[model samples]
Structures are given as structure tokens and as C-alpha cells.
Target chain A: MSNCIDFYFDYSSPYGYLACERIEAIAAKSGCTVVWHPILLGAVFKITGQKPLTESPLRGDYAVRDFSRSAREHQLEYQHPAQFPIGAIAASRASLWLRDNSDPQLRAKTADFIHAIYRAYFSAGQDITDATVIAAVAGSLDIDSEALLLAIATQAVKDSLRIEIEQAISAGVFGSPTMIVNNEPFWGHDRLEQMERWISSGGW
Target chain B: MSNCIDFYFDYSSPYGYLACERIEAIAAKSGCTVVWHPILLGAVFKITGQKPLTESPLRGDYAVRDFSRSAREHQLEYQHPAQFPIGAIAASRASLWLRDNSDPQLRAKTADFIHAIYRAYFSAGQDITDATVIAAVAGSLDIDSEALLLAIATQAVKDSLRIEIEQAISAGVFGSPTMIVNNEPFWGHDRLEQMERWISSGGW
Candidate 1:
């Protein structure tokens, strides 16, 4: 019964990016803190037997359309990245690295790194799979760029991400933007309203 | 574009059942007519390579929980049917039969039939795969029970359903409760708000 919302997301996910934009506000409204967990959907999909939204047959097209439509609905700026469904390992590991930093101020910037990295990929259409681009995005936020690049490449940071993905799968998360509130899992960006309701009402 | 919302749903889908409860009201708010297309998800799943929500590994459990949570969110009565993810072929054909009926009154009850069948399956916990159960639900709605049953049994009615399903697939419908407004497809009950916004504003 902790006052926390576990926000599980993959950096390559459009819906995950959309959720990142609003999840904080939703969490704050309910007096709850959000714990952002960036996991590789590629690994999770292996277990779930699911494909990326933009790669699935009929759903791929619909997903692309819905991504932009949903962004507009949320009043957020969105551009479909030319290189979508990219390997988000660098960005995800960077997020974990920031969170694991010993300095409190650096650790607190994990959320900032997440938002910036997501914006770079989804809005600016940057290739986040590249460690250089990830470092640049981190540097833009005043985080130590060299430290981030070095950290993400380390065995510890990579294993942290791997372990996190395994933990996410064990937690019954099969998709992006899954918010766990009070042990109840809500999947997808569309479920945010329902999650908010669950938070406000303390579980119906 | 036509001022119609094409609602494609499968009876076995819980989200489809949830969408059935609110789609008419959503359509009416935008001064649009609802054209209900009952299609088989089993057939769609063959093309999409999807398993039913209650049958998928991790998602199966979450979907079962979300079914009741979503129903409660909409203030609709719901019970997890003991027999879930039942083959909805009988109910699908029944709906098509009602829609194709020569009698204007019988044809007009297509929406009623959809709602009743969904409620019978999801709320009343009845085995909707049973044609007798579908007939009983339709009979309770003042629809002609014997004639409806006989109509669904015909090869013509079955082919009508097949054609409609094919048409639905052709229209890019790969999941239940897909509402196509202005040729823009919106999938899932979760997308209703976005779809309503699309209808009200005529797309972004």
C-alpha cells in the first residue's frame, strides 16, 4: 500500500512517450510518486509473442495513425520518427545509470533524462539507438555526457536494464506505458484515465 | 465521408462488449448513425496472429481483470462468465440475420440484439456460443425467437456473416470494437474518447 505508481515503458514506444508526458501530472494529482522503469520491449515481446505496433500487419498501420491522433488528443507535439521501433538500449541504460547515480541531484535527473530522450526520438526524430545521440541528449540537460556514455556501455548498467526487463515481465507487463498502482496493473496510454480514477477512488 | 460510425465487434471480446454499452450514446452525441458489423475475431485473429485476451499468457489475466474494471468504470453491470472467450459465430450470424431481415422492425433491433447478446454473455454469465442462449436473449428483447433461430441456421445468413467479416478485414479492422469514422479506423474501447473527438471535430 505504498503511494507509488510504477511506470513501465520502452523508449521506442510512441504510446510510452505519450504516457511519459502526462504520467507525472497524474501521479502528482493523486499524491503519489512515479517510479519510471525503462525496459526493453524487444525482450518483453519475446516472452509475450507480440510484435512492435508499427511492425504488426493490420495493426501496424492503425498504430501509426493512432500515434499521431493520440498525440494531438493529448495536445502534445509529436512527429513520427523515420527510424521507429529502434533499439532503445542506450536510452534505457542511460536512464538506469542516472537513477543509480550516487549524487542525489544526478539521480533526480533520471526523469528529466527520460523526457528529454523521448522527446529527442519521438519529436525531434533523433536516432536514440546510437550512444552518441543519447549522450548528446543527456548533455543537453546538463547531465555529464561522458559519464553517461561510459556508464551505459558498462556491464553493470546493461545488466541493470536486462534485470529490469525480466522483472517487468515477471510483473505481468506485456506492453508499454503500463502503470502499476497498488499492485493493480493498467496497460496502455488509454488506461491512464482509468488509472487516475483508480488512484483517486483508491480502487473501486 | 458518410455520417456513420462503422462499429466492428466480436461477441467473445470483453472490450467489444464494453464498447457495445456506450457506442450508441457516443454516436448520438455526434449526430451520427451506428452501423454495427458483427465479425468473428477468430477469423481476424488468424490474419492478425492474435490470441484471445483471456487466453494469452500475461495479457490473459490482465484482460480478465480489466474487463470488470472497464465495465465498472462505465457503470455497467458485469460478471466474468465461467465460459469465456466462447466462439461467437452463432451470435455474429444472428446479428447479421437481424440486420438483413426484410421486416423493418426486426432489422431495427440489431443494436438491441448486440447489447442483449453481450450482456447475456458478459453479465448474465450465459454461454453465448449456444444458439439457444442467443435466441433466449433475443426472445427476451421481444425479437421473434423461432424465426431468428431459423434465419441464423440458413446458409445465406452464414455466408452473409462471412462476407461481412471479409469486408471488415478489407476495411483494416483487425480487432473487436473497431470504429471507423470518416474512414479513419479507431481500435479498442479505450479509443472511444479519441474516436468521439474525431467525430466531433471531424479528425485532426
Candidate 2:
């Protein structure tokens, strides 16, 4: 098995944002690398017949409370996004474009771009569904904002994200913040510790 | 805001079984008592539009795997029941009957019966949906098996369980192993640690 963790997440997922903030440290502790795969939960939900957490009946209220409580437990900053559960298509496409960039420097900034976008939406309550908002977040991190905006709008980048979501669904990922280590899937941000234990113990 | 943890769970829920094995110590650590509420997820699912974890599409396979893996993580023995996702109506009724008994000693055996029923189903692969199976498990604990069976079969016991499920849904409990500490709902067994922190730190 590869010493890499495949981290699957949706930009609009609060748990996904929380996982992105903590997965790196958990991965580094066991000498493992994290491979981030940004996907659309909306697409996965179509097959899984699931709805957004905040839109569900009873779970909706608990999910909103858990989002901030979980973040505080991890000592991470979180604020409820004004417009949540957004499409996040532009941000997801931007992440994939950055990761697949030919330039190693831009590729290395993929994680940064992901964190920035998540922080912008979850911490600062920004509307990340807007391409310009995504571009501005990228620009703040020394990335070429205009290029990213253009790249995400291209059919190739959009298709790349579509394929990634399909692959994620095929791999048995039905939720955000799913971490796969050694081909075993752990879903939810709550499974991070279990995922770490699986890595440190070399599978239990 | 009571100094007690209202633990709502379904007998057929694997995570609920796992939580049952650990909640007391967590409660005791913070000088809190645990009030076990045996709920029917099937009823809640009717309103929440959720299916059993092991019945969902991609999540089904992962839930099956997570059941045993999570059990192992907690160092608890687990065997998947041959007839999974059983109704567990009999066990739930029996649990309520035991808890509401006039005799204090029989009322005290409520926890024992809860553990026995869960262990029989999850650890020993017994069909807890059967009233006779539930009775036999209760008999092993020195409880009056005949009386228990008769009690669980009564309209009163059945109504009690129905009312309990209604109350659980009213309180926003849509899943198994939901622990409500100080009126704050923490769903899933994985949140036990956060629940403990909430107890120890008096909320964040």
C-alpha cells in the first residue's frame, strides 16, 4: 500500500473544512503524505440519495452546532457561512487545476489554495461559489488570480473535477472528509483519529 | 442542564452498542450520571428519511466495515449478527419495562439487561428481535424471564416505547448513540470524546 492518504472533500462541507485543517498533522505524524481530492458532494448525493447536513430535518440543527463545536475542540477558527452549502464548483475546479498544473511551484500551492478557500468560506463567511471570490482567495496566496479564474472556467478543468467526483463515488466515498489509507475508507471528519490509528498501527 | 447524560440509542445500532460499553466511565469521570434511553431508529428514520447504515448504497459497505473496526478500536469484541438491522422492538420494549419496574433491584438491572441484549446481538450474534431471545438473555441476568416477556408484550410497554421514540425525535435525535449532555446533543459514538470534553470543561 502506498504511504499516502487520499483525502476526499467538498469545499462547501464544514466537516471537510475541519478535516483539511487537521489531516496534514495527522498524516505527518505517521510519515504519510496527504493527496487531496476535491469533489462535489452534490454529485455524490445524487447517487447516495443524501441531502446537505444543514438541510436535513433533525440532523440539520445538530450538524450546525457540531460544526463549530468540533472546530473549537480542534482549536480551529470557524464561522457559519452566510450562504452555505453552495455549489462550490468553481473552487473545486480551481483546486484540481492547481494540482494538475505543469509548474511544480503552482502544484505545491494546491494545498494552500484549498486551505485559503476553505478559510475564506468557513472562517470568514465568504461566498466561495463565486469564481471571482475564489480568484481573490488565490491571489492573496501569491497565485495568479486571473489564470486560475480562466483555468477553472475551461471545459478541461471542469471535466477533470467531474471525473474526480465520479471516481470518488466509485471508490465508496459517500460523504465529505473521507480519508482512505491503504485502500480502507474512513468517512466523516470524526474518523480522523481512527484513520490516524490505522496508519500508526499499520492497519488494525 | 441537568448533571446527567441522556444517551439515546437503538438496540440494532452497532455504534450504539459500542457507546453502551463506554459511556458510564465517561460520565463518571465528570461526576455525571448516564440515563440510557433505548430508542428505535426505525421510527426516527421514518421522519428523518434515513435508512440503516448497513442499508445505504456506498455507505452500506463502509458501515459494515466500520462496525467491527470501531469495535476493535475500543477493544470490544464484536460479531456481525447473521440477521442484521433487525427490528429490535422486543429488546427496546424490554429495556423500558425493566427501567420502569416498581422494584428498585429490577430497575437497577436495566443497564445489565441493556448490555446483555446488545452483547447477545452484536457480540454473540443472537437474534434480539425475538422476544424469546430477549427473555432468555434477561433470564441469564437473574431477572424474571416470564414476567419480563409478559411485560414487554403489554400495550403499556409498547405505548411507552412509541412515546419514547416520539420524544427522541422531538429532541432532535435522528441517529444512534446520540448523547445529550447539558441539553446539547452529540450524535454518534465517535463524539464521546467531545462529549466528555464538554462535560469536563463545562461546555466550550
Candidate 3:
């Protein structure tokens, strides 16, 4: 219905952070807006009977290796966080709060918040599971730190994230870094190239 | 130790078939031999506590869609087999049988046999769970159908397939179409490009 691409991700996901780094530019090239939806993949995993790729034995080791390799290949800043698989409740809630409060002057602020959260977890190797860390990241962006910390605990922000997760599940999204263009789901950061081709060619 | 890429795959994987269609060309360009190993992912799943991608609700739906999209993207033929998740035991054993019988002229025949089996399972939509069907596929490839059928049934071929599965598991293989080069594992057909880059640059 809208001329926007749905980019679903979880703040704790390395692949999600990778997608966020490149998605906006990729979407802009196709003249589409990216609607970022930060959701809890742990909840989705429970429903899909799936576990994090980094939790499975061999895949866990391979994912850690690939995460850094992919970052190097893409020329992005990356470092595996010390406290991985951290709860992203604060970050997810803060992202929604920023989006809900967006004004003409603050239209780009939402993206800044998303990127800052990702950077904290991925690039800086900071433990982002704490609300204080999320608030600090927001505060660095000139946003009200105390207000963000308060907003993340608000019922509205929490419900908004829950609704986003539910919508993602209903949309057949079972993984983080899932991009949906014109309602077709392309799962994983690896499919970004294919998604770009689909957007440019209008489905080949 | 050899100038070869260890390509581990299961016959029932559409992505594996996609990899088979292009792996040889990719490997040839790198001046590397692709040593194909057909192992039962079902066995690996037992150890990893994983299930088929197609068995995970929304992911299952996404995988089927991605399979065809990937096929079209690669200019390869693909059809989701009617016998979804068909047993790959027969095909795995047949592949081992062909490798064991490889002579100077038959050195390349093993790959041919593997490709034919993939074609039967994916493009032809044939039920490859049956040893007879695998033998028939090999027969069409100018391989000895009767001998191939007999070979698949032999204890040697069965044990070889089991050993390959054990080796794959020991080598940290947890999914279909896992490419291992220089002791590094690159999982999925999606990583083919990354793997090629790794091969070309000899690691970054």
C-alpha cells in the first residue's frame, strides 16, 4: 500500500546491525523509503522453534567468524560485543520512541538513534543490555537522556515493540534483517543484493 | 592439504542443487578441485538440535520462495519437489559409489553423477529417496545403471556415506551446501560470492 520497504531487525543481532549499515543507501538508490522496525528476534525464535545462529554449535562458531569477515568485506566498523546475545529491550523501545516523536526537524533523528544503538552493540563492543547504556547513546545524540530512559519503560513504547514483533511474524518474518519490498520477504543480509535487483528491475 | 574445496551438501536441498550448478565453474576459475561430499543433513540435525529450514513455519515459506527466486536469478531450473524433504540416503550412497569407481577417465564422472542426482531431485521433481531412481539418474549420465544400483546397496558404499556424514559433522558442518576452504567454513549458497572472494584474495 505504501511505497516504503519494511526493514525488520533486532538491535542485538550482528546481521541486523550489518543490514542497518547499508539498507538506507540501498533503499534510496531505488527511490524507496526504509521503514525500520526494531523487534525482539528472541520472541520470534520461540514461535518458529528456532534459536539464534550464534547459539548453535558449528553455526555459532561460523557465524562469529563470518560476522567479522563480512564487516571487513563491506568495509564497516565492527567488533563482537563482550556481552553478546544481550537483551535488546531498551534499544528496541528507544527506537520506537524516537520514531513516534519524529517531527520535521527531527525526521532524520530516528535513523541516528537506530545507528547509535547498533554502533554501541557492534562497533564499540559495549554492553547495550542496560537501559543506562541506551540512554547514554541517546544522550550523546543531543536527545534527552533521562526522558529516553523513562520512555523506554512506558507502556506505549513496550506495546509498540510487541506489536511490531507480532506484525513481523504475521508477515512471515522469522529472522532478523528481513527486508520486505512490495510485500515479498527477503530474509537475511545476504539477500540485500537480490532485493536491490528486484527493486531496480521490478521483479525479473 | 590438496588444492581442493570441500563441498558438503545434501541431495534434498534446493540451495545445494543451485550450488552444484555453478560450483564447478567457480572452482575451476580458482584452479581448485571441488571434492563433493553428500551427507545426510538429518543426521547432522540430530547433533545440532536443528531441523530442516523448510520445517520452521515462516522460514519454510520464505525458503521455497527464495529457492525459485535464486534459481531465476542464477538462470537455473528449479522446482520444489513434490516429495518435499525426501530422504537423500540413496543419492548420497550413489555419489560415494561413483567416487570409489573413478578411474582416469572417470575422474570427472563423480561430479557428473552428483549433478544428475541434483537434477533429478530438483529440476525433474523426481523422488530421489529411492535407490532405483538414483540409479536411473546415473544411468542417464552414461554410468552403469545396474552396477551403480548394486554399488549403492553394497556395505562399502553405505559405510562410505556414513563416514562422510561423520567427517562432515566432525568438520563442523551443520547445514547443506557448506563450503570449507583452508579449514574455514562458509555455509549456504548465499556465501558463494564471499567464498569466491576469499579464494581469490587468499583471505583478507
Candidate 4:
């Protein structure tokens, strides 16, 4: 049986972006596949009654310090994401629509698009809240930028987001970059290694 | 004004119990007061999209490894708490009432209560889920065990628990053993030093 990890991601999260980048390598090494599910992180928070990281100064301050520690531990290149809490709604919708095509390379291409958007926001310090950056991301994916834009423009994407939020709540998901394998949810980027460990243990 | 750290605690949590023992010493040295708040960790999980440590095999696995490391680093005498997800409701309700009595010796006494409870559960392999054990904890306080039991039997105590839960959700808390000073929450025992730093800075 093929082992799969269902990843719930939001483009605005630096850890989500980092996890997206690192998980594939980890998954490949562990003989597992990542199933990407893009959902609005803001909505997840609203439904779950979570305040932003900025609310608990510890969360924000520790996030800054913790990410530094994590990057070093993982041996990944990371600096603080320049514009935090960047608008992720658009990208989330686009990725949901992209899944309908169901191409085998869909997950990889979508990851690339998401990674590029993260770079644009965190590294390039561009306005990911701007539609042009999103369109550029879709264009780079060779996905029809116009159709993708139109799809996100409709309520279809919005409704999909609603369902995703509800499902995540029901599943007891609390934070970003959650990996669910075999009905179990693994939270946080730091947990990626444990996910690999579980897979190597035969996806128990 | 004496600096205060708003403390989030659950009775059956060995870490919460251990922290109560050490925090007093740490605070005395650092010079701060622990304003204890009895909150249900279950409610924190419900609202914050978090799962109990019991639910995440990966988190549970990591916690075991991490606690072993923390034990060494903090120079703590720790044996991992067994019979986890033990009913903490009684403990929190007991603490809420205990704090109200305002005995001059509450701080030191509270630390002793926590130490005995943690050691009983972790080292002595006692079932803290048993009411007899809980009654013994109450007895250790020298209050009439029956009166303490009767006090925890009220609707008012449950309401106080609810209010504490609401406050934690409002404060953006997502985990246990969270410390707060002047409405600033510093989560995890690891962030205790930063909580101290924030108090010194007057940046709030």
C-alpha cells in the first residue's frame, strides 16, 4: 500500500511554505506521497477561536526565535517572513480549483506555485496581497491564469474554503502545516520528521 | 506593583504540577508572583484547533524525547507522568477554591501540594484518577477533606472554570503551562525567561 500524508497548507505561513519545501524531500526519502490541501488559515482561526500570533507576544516573539532555531536544526535557509499574515485567501482558492484537474504532477506544480508566492512575500517583500503576484504565480505554473483568476473570483472557491474549514475543525486541526496520515494529524513543521518516522514504521 | 504572571494550569498535568513547584522558586529568584488561573486544557484545545497530547502519536513521541532532554537541561527530577489524560477537572476546581482561602502559606503550600501529586503519579506510579488519592491531596492541605469536597461540588466552581476558559481563549492561548504577566502571555516553560525579560523591559 502506498503511504500518503494529507497536508493542510496556507500560502501566507512561512512555516507552511518551509514545510512545503522540505516535506517532499522528506517524503521522497521515506517513500511517502504528500497530498496537498489548501485552505484559508484565517477562516480556520475564526472558527476555532484563535487569536493571531501577535496577540500573545510570546507566540510572536517565540515564533521569531523558534523559526531561527528550527531553520538551523533543519539546515534550511530562512529569514523572518517580511510581511506576515499576508493575504492567503486568493492562493488557497486557486489551489483548491487546481485539484479538480487531478494531474499526477498537480501536487508538485502547486507546491512550486505556493513556494514562489512565499518567496515573493517573505524574500522579495512583494505585495502578495496584490492580484498580480498571484497571477504571476499561476502563470509560472503554466496553469491558465485567467481561468484560475475567474475560478477564485466565484463563490465556488469560497464555498470550498468553507467546507475545508469545517472539516479541519471536525478533525481537530489547530495549526498550520498539519500532516494527517491514516486518520492521525501531526501538527507543526517540526513534526515533519515524526511523520516520516511514522511512514517508515509502515503508516501505523 | 509586584509583577504577576497569569498562570494557566491543570491538576493532572505533571508538567503543570512540576511547574507549580519550580515556578515559585524561579519567581522568587527572579522576583515575580504567579497569579494562578484554573482553566480546562480541554477547552483550550476545543477552541484553538489543537489536539490533546494523547491524540498525537507524533507529538506524544516527541514529548517523551523532549521531556527527557528538558529534564536534563532544567536539572529537574522528572519521571514522565503515567495515567495521562487523567481527570484534571477535580484538581483545577480544587485549586480555584484553594487559592480563594488565601492562606498566608498558600504559595509554599501550593508548591508542596503539586510536588506530592506529581511525584505520586510519576514516580510512585499512583493512579491520580482515584478519588482517594485526590482526597489525600486535599488532606495534605490540612483543610477538612469533606469541606473541600463539598466546596468543589458547587455550580459556582464550574462557572469559574468556564470563565477561566473564556479568558484563555481570549488571550490566544493554545497550550498548557502558559505564563502571563500584565496580560502578556508567555507559553511553555521554555518561554519563562522571556516572560521575565518582558517584565524588566516595561515595554508593555
Candidate 5:
């Protein structure tokens, strides 16, 4: 009755951040291991017909209420990213570089980074294009800030993040924080408990 | 730390029917009591500016895919209901009538009645406007079909259903199967685990 949970993530997704925040506790409770799988949201959206905030019809008036209900229900804080579709390339790259050699607890740390970045972008209307905030988020998790910057700059990490994006596309992942446990995919933060229960129950 | 859970429902909402199926199981697990609420979808759409299905941009189309994934993850069977948006006045009235006979474990039976009606509309694509199916559904529930239908016609059950709707509106019930523990509302079936946890932690 053992399995590994691969959590697909993107820094720009507040929902992804929400899953990162608490999925580990659930995983622990359900007796499963967590793996961090960072993918490019931009790529996933290209094929999924998923549009950024400004492009979605319900955005200007309804999205705020829509997401607020979901976020508040999940007990995660959000305001709206200041910059629409903030370039997540660097954030993804840093996340990739910090993989394996860094903490596998990346699940929890990544959740934190997603929240801080969402707050930075949507609520305060800050520039997520700045490497400083990204680095600060990494630093807050005790991961090396300077190293994260270097990692973001390295072509290897950059290309790796790009590959992760490609991988998400090839694997049919269309959303953030898609918890893939035992090769079963649960697409939203709302599906987290279902994934854990799937694992806990040995995939039924 | 006890609070009433006001469940807002549109008898025509497939999602509401879906949520109703396992709601009491969820409530028992979460230690919450559900106040069965029935609101007219036609009325809600009029006030909230939520468009009717034919006008709402097929947002629900893609949602079926997501819900399919969720259902699979949860190990639940989700055959899309047959008939949707059936004339729910009778069913809603009947549910209000059943409230007087509250049984802690009867939600599943209640859900069956709701599901049968949804099937009458969506899957069968029948005119749920048919009195026969409505009578059949109520009869199947082991409820007195003549009495229930008579109650719907007499304004007795209709008035009770209206009061439940007003109660839900006053309690800020925005959606169905909403779990309110200690007056804090958690809308959607997905939040059942958190609702349970919130209760276990004494409303945190």
C-alpha cells in the first residue's frame, strides 16, 4: 500500500501554492511520499485552451469573486497577481534547479513560494519580473538565494524547466498542482484529498 | 463550536445532485449537520447574474472532464445524470416535507430521489415535466406519492420550501452541499474533508 505522489506546480498559480501549503500533511497522514514536479504554465495553457486572466471572459468582473471563494474556502490568501501572467520561466527554473539536491520537501516550500509570489503579483501589484522577490522567496525557505539566481540563469536549468513544460504537455497535464499519484491525475487543489485517499486505499 | 450547515441547492443542478449523493457520508465524517435547502435555479440565475446553461458559455462542458478526473480519483461512479433542469417544484417540496422526518442516515435515500429526478431529465433526456416520472421517483422513495404530490399542489410544502430558501439566503448560502460548521460556510462537495477537520479541531 505504498506509493509516491508527484505534485505538478507553477509559481504563478495560487491554487498550486495552496496545494503546496497543506498537501504534505495530508500525504503524511495518508502515508505517501511527495515529489515536486515544476512545469511551465504557459506551455500547458497553450494546448489546453486555458487563457490568462486578461483573456478570459469572466475576468474583469467575475474572476475575483470566483477565485476568492475558492481561495477562501481553501483558507489560502490571494488578491490577484499584479502582473497578468508574470513570466514564470525564472521561477520554474529556480524550482527545477533546487530539485533533488535541494529539499524534497519542495512540495511544502513550493506551496509557500506560490503564495508569496501570488501575493506579490495580484495583491500588491508588484513586479514578479524581478529576480529579487523570487530569490527572497527561496531564501525564506533557507534555500540559497544566490544559488537560485545562478540556477535561474544557467542554460541547463532554463532548458530543464522548458523540458518540464514540454513534459507536462506530452503527459496531458492541463492545470497546476495536478497531483499524480500512482499515475492517476487529479487536476485541481480541490482534488488533493482524493489523490491521497487513492494512495491510502491502494488505488482501490 | 457547533454551527448549522446551510446547504444551498438548485434541484436542477447536476453538481448539486452529485454532491447530494454522498453529502451525509461527508457530514458524518466531518461531524456536521446539513440543513436541506432547495432554491429555484431559475430564480438564482435571475438575481446573481449567472446565466442559464444554454447561455453560460459551456463552462460546464470542460468542467465535466475535471469532475470525471475527480470522481475517478475519489473512486466514485459518475454517470452524468439523464435529465437536467426537471420541474423541481415537486421534488423540492417533497424534500422540505421529509425534513420533519429527519433521519441522520437518510441523506443517501434523499440523494437517490434527487438522482432519479436528475436522471429523468439529463440522461433520459425526457421531459421531467412528466408527472409519471415524478410520481415514480417519489413512490420509489417509499414516500407516499399521492400525499407528496398533494402537498406540492396545496401550497403547504411549497411554502416550507420557500422558507428554507429564504433561510439559506439570509445565511449567505451561495452554493450547494455547503457545510457550515459553527456558522462558517464551506461551499462545494470538495471541501468536506476540511469541514471535518475544522470540526475535529473544534472549529480551529
Candidate 6:
């Protein structure tokens, strides 16, 4: 009976960053809550037979251009990362650590961590694959930096992400910034408007 | 220099059909003309390592739903063709045949033929892979059916489509509904808004 939307994203996706920037406002307007699921897109790609949009030949060039243009259009600061499509395992595990804490304050901290990571990768052009960078981001977010890094390296945390990724793939998520509402999947950040309309109308 | 937008599409692309339904109006409002270039997406796919979107695993299901929902959002009548991602060789060749003819009036008829084929394949759910069906769609636009069929079968027409496909690929056109303005590429029907804004602002 909850009017909650499940948002799936990979840390390295520019559009995922863009979607993260907007989804909260769209949900707030409709009195809905979003449950964020940060997963490794590489796992999803294994099942979908897709590569990173920026690695797909001609689309790679267009994607690079559109990433900047779309960010500007949305009035969000963006600079292409030096190490793009970086391995986001650390970031994803960091998010899971925050989400699993069950402390409401720490739960709020999850958003801060996710947003900072996105900004670090996209706006500041940082390499998020480095555990030191991720720990620094969490430290800036007022979370325990050393603790977060240790948690991200734990076997339990790694397995948690692996299991959830398998579940996400089986649940039909093959792309970043895919939203699931009432069991219907909506893919792409551009679809936020349609998703808003669907939420408002309870779907057609 | 003409302020014309080069529109590239594949007949089997639902997004391409959706774009065909809208691009002319968007251009007319901006005092820009649209030059339609219908090419085989398969050729682009060869370079990009992408298959028909509907053939992808989890993404395939989402695409079908998005196609219908997006169509309704635009108030365009849409019925998915029974044979999707169909062999569009006949349709593309037919379009080139119409385009290659030097008569200005016949060139104008090309739009009529293109729209009809889109409607036949998408709205009417007709199998446009059939040469007879393509000729029939052309016939609806007052083109001679038998002559159209014969023209679509010509080696020149087939070769003409091949050269354009190569040209589109070389031009970095990797997807359907790609719009090129001032030599910058904009991909997707979703980017039509951005395309309009680009035309209005004459590029950022």
C-alpha cells in the first residue's frame, strides 16, 4: 500500500547522477518516497549484453556530448570524470553500509554520501574507484571515514551487493536510472517527466 | 547556408516513427527545414555493436511499454507492429527511390510516402518487411504501386541505400531519430525538446 518508487542506479552513470539530482523533488511533489538501489552496472550488463554507453562505438561520442549538454540544460554542474565508468564497488558498498545501519540519522546520511560521490565523480571529475576518495567523501559527509572503508571491504558487504545485483538483474533492470513503480519499469532519466505523470495519474 | 536539420531514421524504429510525426512541425516553427534521411539501423548497429533495442534482454520489455506510453503522452495513435524490428530493407529502399528522383513534386511525395509507411507499420501493425506492403503504403500516397515495387527491387536503389547507410555511420549517426544541426549530433526522440532549444538558441 506504499506509494514508493524503487530507483536503480550505478554510481558511474552520468544520467544516473542527473536522475539522482531530480528524482527526490519529483517524488516529494507527489508525496512518494524513493528507495535507492545502487548496484554495479557491470553485473547487469553481464545479463543484458550491453556495454557502458560511452564504450559503444559511435554512441560513445554522442553520450559524452549529451552528458555535458544535458547537465547544463538541467542547471547542474558537470565535468566529465578523468576515470569514467570507474569500478563503483566501493561506492555501492558504502551506500549499502549506510542503508543497512537502520539508524534514521545514518539513513539520511546515505543521501549525502550518494550525492557527494556523484558530485565527486561528475562535477569535480574525480576517480571514485579509489577507496581513499570514497572514504574522504564519507568523512566530509560526517560519517566515520575509516569505519566506512573497513565496512566496504568486509565479506558481508560485498556479498550483500552481489546478491542485490543478482536480484536487480532478475527483476529486469538492465540500465542505470531505471525506476520501478507498482511493478512497471521505467528506464532513463529523460523518463522522469513521464514517471511524474504516471505517479500523478496512478498510471494509464 | 540553409538552417536545415538532418534527420536520420530507420523505418522500423518506433522512436523514428514518433520523431517523423513531430520533426516537421518543430522545424516549421523554427523556420528550419528538415531533410529526412531514412537509413538501415542494422548498418549502424554493426559499427556500434548494438542490436535492436527490443532484442535486448530486460531492456526489451521496458522499451515496448515505453513506446506505447510515450506515444500516448504525445497524443499519437500507436499500435505496435506484429513484426517488430522487421527487415526494413524494402522500406528504406523505397524511401531512397522517392528521394533520388529529381522532381521537386515527387520529392514532396516522399514525406507522404514516409508517413504512410510509418503509419502502416506502427499504427496499422502491418508487416512493412513485405515489399508488397511497402508498395501498397506508397500507393496510398498516390505513388504507382507496381512501379514503386520494381523501383525498390533495383540494384541502384539497393546500392543507394547502402551508400547512405555508410554515410550516416561515418557521420556518427549510431541511432535512429538522430538530429544533426550545425554538424552536432543529437540522439533520441526524447531529445527533441533539446533539439528545439538548440535551434532556437543556435547552439550553446
Candidate No. with top DockQ: 2
Model 2 misplaced regions, further than 4 Å: none
For all candidates in order, state the fraction of native interface contacts they contain. Answer: 0.69, 0.86, 0.78, 0.00, 0.08, 0.69
Off by over 4 Å in 5: A1-3, A22-34, A39-87, A97-128, A135-163, A169-172, B1-3, B12-15, B25-33, B40-78, B82-90, B93-129, B141-174
Candidate number with greatest TM-score:
2
| DockQ for each model | 0.73, 0.81, 0.78, 0.06, 0.10, 0.69
Name the runs in model 3 displaced over 4 angstroms.
A1-3
Q: Please, what is the TM-score per model?
A: 0.95, 0.96, 0.95, 0.57, 0.63, 0.94
lDDT of 1 by residue, A1-204 (tens): 448999999988999999999999988888999998999888877777878777777888888878888899889989999987788888888899888888998999989889999999899988988878887888888988998888878999889999999899999999998999888999999989888888888777
Name every residue pair that clashes in candidate 6. none
Query: On residues B100-124, what C-alpha lDDT tens digit does candidate 2 reach at each position?
Result: 8899999999999999999998898
Q: Give the candidate number with the greatest lDDT.
A: 2
DockQ class, candidate 3: medium
Which 10-residue span in candidate 5 chain B carries the lowest summed lDDT?
Answer: B53-62
Looking at model 2, residue B35 earns an lDDT score of 90
What does candidate 6's lDDT look like per residue over A1-204, in tens digits? Answer: 437989999998999999999989998998889888998898788778999999889899989988888888889998988877777988999898898886777778987788999999898877888888898898887898898888878999999899878888888898889888888788888888878888888777
Chain A TM-score across all models, in listed order: 0.97, 0.97, 0.95, 0.87, 0.81, 0.96
Alpha-carbon deviation at A176 in model 4, angstroms: 0.5
Q: Please tell me how candidate 5 rates in CAPRI terms.
A: incorrect
Candidate 6 chain B worst ten-residue window by lDDT: B99-108
Worst 10-residue stretch by lDDT in candidate 4 chain A? A49-58
Candidates by lDDT, descending order: 2, 1, 6, 3, 4, 5
Candidate 1, clashing residue pairs? none
Which pairs clash in the backbone of model 4? A174-B49, B6-B180
